[model samples]
Target: MIEYFDRGAIVTSSLCAEVMKKMRNEIRKKRQGKLEKVLLFHQDNASAHRSAIAVAAIRDAGFEILKHSPYSLSLAPSNFFLFPRLKENVKEQRFEDNAAVVAAVQEFLGAQDEEFFKKIILSYKKFILKVYYNKCDYVEK
Candidate 1:
């Protein structure tokens, strides 16, 4: 699930579309013969993420896009799970360049075991249920 951008490259809608294609390929390979399982793709409502190109790419890959509602920001897996750990890991670390930053992030991510990812997913599920029961209102941490 790691995709790196070039030094000066921006993450445009086209880039996101390309990434969706790659992700689809990876998922297909992982599932192998389990083609009946639906792919539920969750992404924040960033401009690139909501772009027509990105939407079309997701549809082309047979993924069901999960809407990222504003009220659900607290329920976002990246916000509640990934980014906090990532920020802590990189905090106060000096990097000479973008590549160094990327390398550091990769190292931090590589150090996480399968249990870490599983825990994040489980936490996300719990948060989602909380949001549902709260009638889509912002949940207290």
Candidate 2:
């Protein structure tokens, strides 16, 4: 999961192109060379980050594209749970704008509890909704 300084203008999801590029680069870095031919592949949506150019770069690097869901949270668990809490924790610190905010955000994220991150994911997946017998309320998926 990745986030930008702000957000992106182009893309299906809100993920910034730079952040996605960085993520792809990081994955490629794990490969010694011939990154376009690596065995491990990532599933990503058709966002700006997953643009045709990005797909070509990824394929050129050597990774297979796994089948992913339309909802990004299914692919990016950190975005669905952990990272938003990090952003919130930073916001709660009440730091001044500019470098301070950035610093606070970084510090909070760096200090996040591993267990909490795990718990958020677990909780998100485990949540169950209540059903009332009154109106036709539930959408059967």
Candidate 3:
């Protein structure tokens, strides 16, 4: 599920669509071809993500795009959880190249278990509840 982009490469609508297709295939394989549960896909409101082609691709992938407000860090689990943990692990470390950096990231992600991912989902749920209780106001960190 880790996708590496080339340095300075722009994320176009086509690229986003392609990645969504790949993600769909990966999710299908993970679910053993039986997706009984609805797939709610979330991404920031980047231009590429909102483009017509990207929206079509997401629909084709059988994923429902979760509504997200612009600049909403409180709703982004990766910002509060995943990336912070990743940064903690890789901080003060020097990698020989992009491959080395990628290897390190792969190692960190691979080390996480189902419980870790479950906790992430749980945290996201909590965040959603907080947002709801706050009447769609800015969620506290």
Is 1 or 3 the stronger prediction by lDDT?
Answer: 3
* Candidates' C-alpha lDDT: 0.83, 0.52, 0.84
Please give each candidate's TM-score: 0.86, 0.48, 0.89
Question: Candidate 1 or 3, higher TM-score?
Answer: 3
Candidates ranked by TM-score: 3, 1, 2
Model 3, residue 17: distance off in Å is: 0.4
TM for candidate 2 is: 0.48
Which candidate has the highest lDDT of all?
Answer: 3
For model 2, residues 79-141, the per-residue Cα lDDT tens digits are 546557777675546655556866766677677789866787566444212111213243222
List candidate 2 segments past 4 Å from native. Answer: 1-46, 71-74, 112-141
Q: On a 0 to 100 scale, what is the lDDT of residue 30 in model 1?
A: 86
Query: Residue by residue across 15-133, what tens digits does model 3's lDDT show?
Result: 99999999999998898958887788877667898999999999999998777755465566677768888999999999888889889999999999999889988887787777767
Show the lowest summed lDDT stretch of 10 residues, model 3. Answer: 68-77
Compute the lDDT of residue 13 as modeled in candidate 3.
98
TM-score of 3: 0.89
Best by the TM-score measure: 3
lDDT string, candidate 1, 42-131, tens digits: 777678888999999999999997656567656556877899999998899888998898889889889999999999888887877777
| Candidate 1 collision pairs | none
